[model samples]
Target: MKKLIKLGIALVAIISLNACTEDDGFTFIAKEDPDGLTFANTPSGSYTLTAANADNMAERFVWNAVDFGVQTPVSYELQGAATESFDNITVIPAGNSTNVAVTVSEMMDLAEEAGLDNDPTTAEPNTGIIYFRVRAYVGSNGGNVVDQFSDVISVTVNLPEQSEEEDEDLPKLYVVGNFLSASGYGTDWTATDGVPIAAEAEGNTAYEGFVYMNVDAPQFKILQTNENFDDNYGDAGETDGVYTGILESPGVNAGTPDGTGGYYLVNVDTDALTYELTETSWGVIGNATPTGWDSDTDMTYDSDTQTWSVTLDLTEQEATDNGFKFRANDAWDLNLGDTDADGSLEFAGDNIGVPEDGNYTITLDLSNPRQYKYSISKN
Candidate 1:
């Protein structure tokens, strides 16, 4: 009876101690990771699972080690599954390291098992996704040992779709800069999310567009494309004031226009390896402002908040029903009108109706991407 009592007390203590590691409503996955496995470098892109590049490292599976709050040695194993459902699982033991790699050949096997093929005649898909996960466990995943699983990562794979026509390389210039992250476009200085400047036409050297960046001294480079950084253009340390700056092939990031910064009308000459920046000044234009439909009432820029605002008297013409729109450089080339009349701005959208005639404060905030908004407040 004493032995039985001791065993019962021991089991209770064991369950109480292990309760901290328990994760409910999950299968081999942790509810939260105090220091759970995190991927280090999983470069983005699709894969063509072919034997030609079999030995090439598809993508290195990297992650931070999991901490079960114990000193026991932890071992990791890489896992793959057909879909988000872990019903069909594949495992690759990675020993005790926190990082491992899945080669093209190995991915090819997984692809074949997932019923993907390069055959053009069959109903099987040439494109599919493979989900990945890594397991962290102590004591060889023995009974009651601490173990946790990382979040699933899905990778798109293709079996090389057959095409009769060759793909044309449409030359494009993507502006990769430090201002992107500040402006909330994407990762700073990364071509993967850089803003694009397309060629004027086929076989043209001039690339023109507008990008709103708040960096006082704009530091940037022009990437050939958004996929890879194989080709790029950047500062050659030559400048003709804020109007233009010289560019060099395969160059590092560089700044332009000294102190002038705001929305810019950019023009890039790829052949000459030079670029120009035209700082745009925005204003309210239409028949409603002090300047009738013919001219624009200039708006002031607030660098602290990165907005264009104006306080002016507006006339509500109930007769002719005239209204105003926002434009840059006192011109129609770069203008915005609210198509939905929902306080949002779209390129060359419809004219905005005046709410009422009054002395009002209007503010335009272009700091956020695709969420350009304007606010009109009566003072």
Candidate 2:
């Protein structure tokens, strides 16, 4: 009987020990990492982005859910960078989801931020390769979660050619110093005398305009504003035509044109930190003009109206069924045409035809830009 009683006590003690160790919703066992956390639908080999494709999806990164051997929810993040190691990474929160669709505009923004040039025409390589990876994490609101990363994938990013119309909202630039004077030095550095760089368009940061330079005062500096020297730029060296030029200190060597001083079209790109001074002249070249298609009839600048104007006699032979267009420096490379034969001037649109042959005063008003207007008044 005693032995039986002892056996019964031992069984009760074993049952009590098991009960003490039981857990309702917790354990000390280490959780296994979620499986199948790989990229399911991968990106393409190459992607070409343009203004038209801004709303289109560039890539849809699909991945399997991570199974952390539990019922815990997981969050996935899509990250990208220029470097393969993702040292300079841009993380895009994908929420507690398994897929994320990136738009072309979004990808372009990322590529540019990653040091890829936005210009496709002149940029070396033209196509930038970007690396991407997916990371999955689990926890209560992302607290105390384990991170698992998928294998990296790369995609080639190609940007469309930057249209002149797209660059119509850049900052302004000015021309100061000897370039304005015959002695290679100007007494008045005031805004009135300081040549203003005409903006490419009304709301553009890029600027272009013609300036007369003489050998005596060939040197010049570019300023953001004509009233102050707070923001001005000069040549980094004596080198001319350096596209990637740096802004030198004041009173330093100024930039000169490639050839002897003449009328130059100064083009400045503030965003790219580049400038170009090319000898240029403006003229009308078309069948409808007095000069006809064989030669050009030049337009003179009217400072009062801030436009180019000319008075010419349009004969019947030149005006009848003939159209005209404006050319820069008498070159076809840079010219203006009209579309729908409307007053709205396009870079290379249709021709502006004469309704009737008569003596007229023509004015090309580029003050508002992109909305360039012109009027031909028959006299």
Candidate 3:
């Protein structure tokens, strides 16, 4: 019995010695979190590091446990470079956690101190590439020694280019005008004979009527020329010296047409009064008028006649109230007249109202020599 007991004690001692030797040879290696680490093309302004171990060695190194035979303090160093090869690296201390985060700005300051022109906000450094790795230190009675390095991770920063263009400013203007008779009769009333007369008060005959145009800004100069005109006489009278008289209205088409006229549509180049008319309502002569002319069509310049025309088939009431107006931004009075086979008695003029932006139409009754219609719109 004594011999058996001594043998059991020897066996226990040998087992303990083997365990000690095995524990002393064990090592704690630095590792990376997520097995293999990844970073954004442009990393967040800051980042953190996490150490992991598949062999369950993290607690031994990261937590400074004694199980791994650590006799002294343990510290960590993070190295970064422009290449995964880790050449020309920068080192920073790792705090007391398995993971450590550092600000890109802070890292940039460190780079500057190291004689590198690296802007964390830009990708100008590291030849447009960045890399990171971790090293762990284990201290013993002899001295501190680096255990192992984690796999290197690549990082990239995307920077925006400096060249971009801005939008351009567009030009705009507002105009107003009045429509009055060119005969001695009141603006709203014309001679029963329907003889076309000039606004002047001399020669064959004279009349007192006027129209006005007002623009928001004075940036643009006016250009006026007679598009068409007719005299009641059989022979086509020369437009010799057509002039425009300016007038004002309480509201669009509200002021008395007989009131003394105010501003004239003078030619920009010649200083002569100008007027224009279209042969056929400028292509807006549809059989049926749409629900909203102002919302549907756009006014275009008629190069041939030097006039702008819009056509509408609205009723007399729509024409008088909403259609025909002499207020500001309501009309463009041309120094021209209507001279077609329809005869002098069928002469008509329109007071087109300008809306926001779009197309519109204006209509006229050829049967009646002295009256016409107009519409304004955008598309």
Per-residue lDDT of model 3, residues 23-77, tens digit only: 4322223223222112121223222111100111111112122233555555566
Candidate 2's displacement at residue 141, Å, is 91
- lDDT score for residue 92 of model 1: 78
Best lDDT among the predictions, by candidate number: 1
lDDT: worst 10-residue window of model 2: 1-10
**Model 1 C-alpha lDDT per residue in residues 173-245, reported as the tens digit of each score:** 7887778877656788787878766563579898766676776676777788887777677777554222237
Candidate 1 minimal-lDDT segment of 10 residues: 1-10
Question: Which lDDT values do the candidates have, in the order given?
Answer: 0.63, 0.57, 0.28
How far does residue 102 in candidate 2 sit from its true spot (Å)?
56
List where candidate 2 sits over 4 angstroms from the true fold: 1-170, 179-187, 191-193, 198-205, 212-216, 238-253, 301-307, 315-322, 340-344, 365-373
Clashes of each: 0, 12, 43
Q: What lDDT tens digits, residue by residue, belong to model 2 across residues 1-379? A: 0000001110000111121122211111101112111111113334555443354344556665555555767777888887898888888788987767665667777677666664545545545777777776767544666666665666666654555435444345668765555523245354446666666555665777656665543666787776787757777665543323455544244555443666566777666666787765667877767667888899886545557778888643321135687787777877776553324466676566553456767776554424555665556
Winner on TM-score between 1 and 3 is 1
Any idea what lDDT model 2 has?
Answer: 0.57
Name the regions of candidate 1 deviating beyond 4 angstroms. 1-171, 200-204, 238-244, 290-325, 329-379
